[model samples]
Target: MGRVTGKRVVITGGASGMGRATAELFAREGARVAVLDAQAEPGEAVAAAIRDAGGDARFFRADVSVERSVGDAVDGAAEAFGGLDVLVNCAGIIGVDKPTHEVSEAEWDAVFAVDVKGVFFATKASVPHFLTAGGGAIVNFSSIYGLIGNDEFTPYHVAKGAVNMQTKQDAASYGRHGIRVNAVNPSTVLTPLVEGIARDFPGGLPAYEEQMTGHQSLRRLGRPLDVAYAVLFLASDEADWITGVVLPVDGGYTAR
Candidate 1:
C-alpha cells in the first residue's frame, strides 16, 4: 500500500510552491487532499489536476492570518473528508526584504501576520479535530534562515524561528494525545516564490539562482521534491516514533 493510503490531509497555501508540491504528493500516495489557499484560480487548478489524475481533491479560499477564515477552512476540510489525519501548515509570505533598520512596522506586522500567525490559526483550528480522529501529524514549514542569519532576510527569519519553537511546543503538549508535530526547514529550493524574490534582488534572477546554488554544499539548490519526500515520511506512520523534531532539507547548506 502507498505510504499515505487512506489518509486525509489538509495543506495550506496549496496553490503553489512547497504547499502545492506537498498536496500533489499526498494525493498521488492515495490520500484525500483538501487545499486551503487564497489564490482562487491556481487553487482550483490544482484540485482539478488532482481529480484528473484519479485522486480526490478539494480547494478552499482562506487567509491564514484571519482566525475566521482559518477556522472555516479547517472545519470545511473535516466535513468533506470525514476526518483529518494530517495538517501541513505551509502558508506564509516573506514580506518585503530589507535591512532591519529600514523595515517598516506595517511590513513587520504583515510578515508576522501570515508567516507566524497563520500557522497558529491553522494548527489550532485543526488540533481538536485531530484529537477526535484519535491522533494526527502536523508538518510546519520553517527555513534555513531561521537557524542562520542573512542581511536582508530579517522578517522571514523571525517568522520561521517562531515556527520552529511552536512545532516543539505543540508536540510536547499533545504527544500524550497521539498528535505528532514536526517541522521541515529547507534551504534554497527553486520555486515561484524564490524566482520572484530573485527578480527583485540586486543581482537579478540568474545571479541569485547561482548564489543559491553556490551556498549549498551539494552545489545544487534544493528541489521541491526533496522537501516533499521528507514531509511525506514525517507525515506517515513510518514516523510514528518521531515528533517535535526539525528536519532540514538544506542541501547541506547549514553544515557549512
Candidate 2:
C-alpha cells in the first residue's frame, strides 16, 4: 500500500480522468501529491480530498503551453512538498477529428502546443529539481495513436509520436543523472475527453463503445484507473531500471 511512501509527486491535468485517478492512487500509496490543472475548483477539490483522507496534497493551476506558468507551478510544487521526486506529464488535448489535408493549421498548432510543448515545458522545469534530488522519475502520457496510425487523428498522432521520441531522448540524456524517463501509451480510455469525442461519432456513445470494444481483446473500453495503474508503476521505484520504453496499456489491441 505504501509503494511510494514519502515520495513527492506532481501530476499535471490532475483534476479529472486519468490524472485524477493517478493523484488519488498516489496519495493512497503514501505519496505527497501536487495536483496541477487549469480548472481551479476541481483541482482544489482533488487536493482537498486527498488531505481529507489523511494524505498530503495541494493544487496548482497553470497552462502547460506557457513556459512561465509551468515553471512557476512546478517551482511552487517543489517548495510545497519540500522536494520533487516524480512527474506525471498527463496534461494533453485531443486534436480535431479531421484528416491531415483538411485540418486547419490552428488546430494542428493547438494540439502540438498542449500535447507536445506542454510535456517539454514541464520536463524542462523538473530537470533541475530532479538533479538536485540526485534522482527522479518522469512518466509521460502518450497514446496508441502515437505508436500507430488511425483515421482522422493526424495532429494528435504527430504530437504523440513526438512525445514518444522526446521521452526516449530525455531518458538517454538524463540516465546518467539518475532521472528515468518513460511513456505510457493507452488505447481508448473512456475519459471525459474521449467521451466527448464519442458523442461526436455517428451513433454517439454506444456506437463508439462498440467500435472501441471490437478492437480490444478484452471486449470493453478502458477506464481511467487502468491507465493510472500503469502510470503509478512507472513512477514508482519498482520501475527503477526501466527507461526510454513505451508501455502500452491497451487490452491486447496492439498485439494484433
Candidate 3:
C-alpha cells in the first residue's frame, strides 16, 4: 500500500486532473505531498483533502511559467518536507488548435511558456535539492501527441515533443547521480478540461469520446487515475532501474 512510503514529492498543477490524482495517490501511499498550482483555492482544497485522509500534504502557489516563482515554490516545498525525493511535472496546457502556419507567434510562445518552459524551470529548480538528497525521481507528463503527430493543437504537440527530448536529456545527464528522469505519454484522459472540450465539440461529448477511442486499441477514454498510476510507478522505488524511458501510458493509442 505504501508504494512511495516517506518520499517527499512536489507536483506541479496538483490542483486538478491527473496532477490531483497523482497527489492524492502519492499521499495515500505514504508520501508528503506539496500541491503546487496557480489556483490557490483548489490547490488548498487538494492538500486539505489529503490531510483529512490522514496524509501529509500542503499547498504551494506558483506560476510554473515564471522561473522565480517555480524556484521559490520548489524550494519552499523542499523546506516544508525537510527534503525532496520526487518532482512531477504535470502542469501543462492544450494550446490553440490552429495549424502550425496559422498560429501566431504569441500563441505559440504562450503554449511553450507553460508546457515546455515550465518543465524546464521546475526541473532546474529541483535538481540541486535532489543532488543534496543524493538522488531522486522526476515524472514528466508528455502526451501521445508528443510521440506521434496529429492534426490538432500544433503548439501543444510541439511543446510536448520538446518535453520528451528534455526527459531523455536530463535522464542521461543525471543517471550517474542517481536521479532518474522519465516521461509518461498518455492518450485522451477524461479530465474536467477534456470533458469541457468534449462538450464543446462539433458533435458533442459522445461523438468526441467515440472519435478519441477510435484511435486507441482499448475502446475507451483514459481516466486521471490511469495516468496517475504510471506516475506512481515512475516515482516509486520499484522503478529504481528505470531511467531515460519515454513510457507510453496510452491505451495502445501509440501501438496503432
Candidate 4:
C-alpha cells in the first residue's frame, strides 16, 4: 500500500507549480485530494487528471487569502472527502519585487495576505477537523529567502520568515491536540515564480541556475518534486515527531 493510502488531503494553490505536483504525487500514493485554487479552470483540470488516473480527487475555486473564500474552500474539501487529514499551504504569490524602501505598502500587504495570512486561514479552518480526527498534518510552504534575506524580495522574504515562525507557534499550540505543524523552506526552484524573476535578468535560466546553484553545497538546481518529497514525508506518519521545525529542503543551499 502507498504511504498515504486512504488519507484525505486538502491542498491550497493546487492548480499549478509545486502545489499541483505535490497534490498529484499525494494522490498517486493513495490519498484522496481536494484541490483548491482561485483559478477554476486549471484547478478542475488537475482534479480531473487525478480522478482519471484512478485516484479520488475534486477541485474547488476559491482564493486562499480571502476569509470567505478560504472558509468555502475548506467546506468544499470537507464535503468532498468527509474530513481533512492533511492541510498543505502552498497558495502564495511572489508579489511586487523591489528594494525594501522602493516596495509599495500594497505590495507588502499583498504578499503577506497570500503567503502568511493564507496559512493562518487554512490552519484555522482545518484545526477543528484535525482535533476532531485526533490529529493531522499542516505543511507550510516557506522559502530559503525566508531563512536568508535577499534583494528584490523584501516583502516575500519577510512573509516567508513569518510563515516559518507561525508554523512553529502553531505546532507549539497544537502538538498536544495531535496536529503536527511544519514548514518546508526550499531554495530557488524551477517554478514559474523563478521564471518570472528570470525575465528581469539578462541571461535568463542559465544565469538564474548559475547563481542559485552556486549558493548550494550540491550546486544543482532544485526541482518541484524535491520539495514535494519533503512535504510527503512530513505529511506522512514518518515525521510524527518533526513538528515546529523549519525543514530545509534546499539542496544543501542553506549549509553555507
Cα-based TM-score, every candidate: 0.97, 0.98, 0.99, 0.97
Quick one: ranking by lDDT, best first?
A: 3, 2, 1, 4
Ranking by TM-score: 3, 2, 4, 1
The per-model lDDT (C-alpha) reads 0.92, 0.94, 0.96, 0.90
Best by TM-score: 3
lDDT (10s digit) by residue, model 2, range 1-256: 6989999998999999999999999999999999999899999999999999999999999999999998999999999988899999999999788888899989999999999999999999999999999999999999989999988678999999999999999999999999999999999999989988898999998899898879777878899999998988899999999999999999988887
How would you encode candidate 1's per-residue C-alpha lDDT over 127-180 as one tens digit per residue?
Answer: 999989999999999998888888867899988999999999999999999999
Instruction: Return whichever of 1 and 3 wins on TM-score.
Output: 3
Report the C-alpha displacement of residue 108, candidate 2, in angstroms: 0.9
Question: Against the hidden true structure, what lDDT does model 4 obtain?
Answer: 0.90
Worst window of 10 by summed lDDT in candidate 2: 212-221
The best candidate in terms of lDDT:
3
What is the Å distance of residue 185 in model 1 from its true position?
Answer: 0.5
Each model's number of backbone clashes? 0, 0, 0, 0
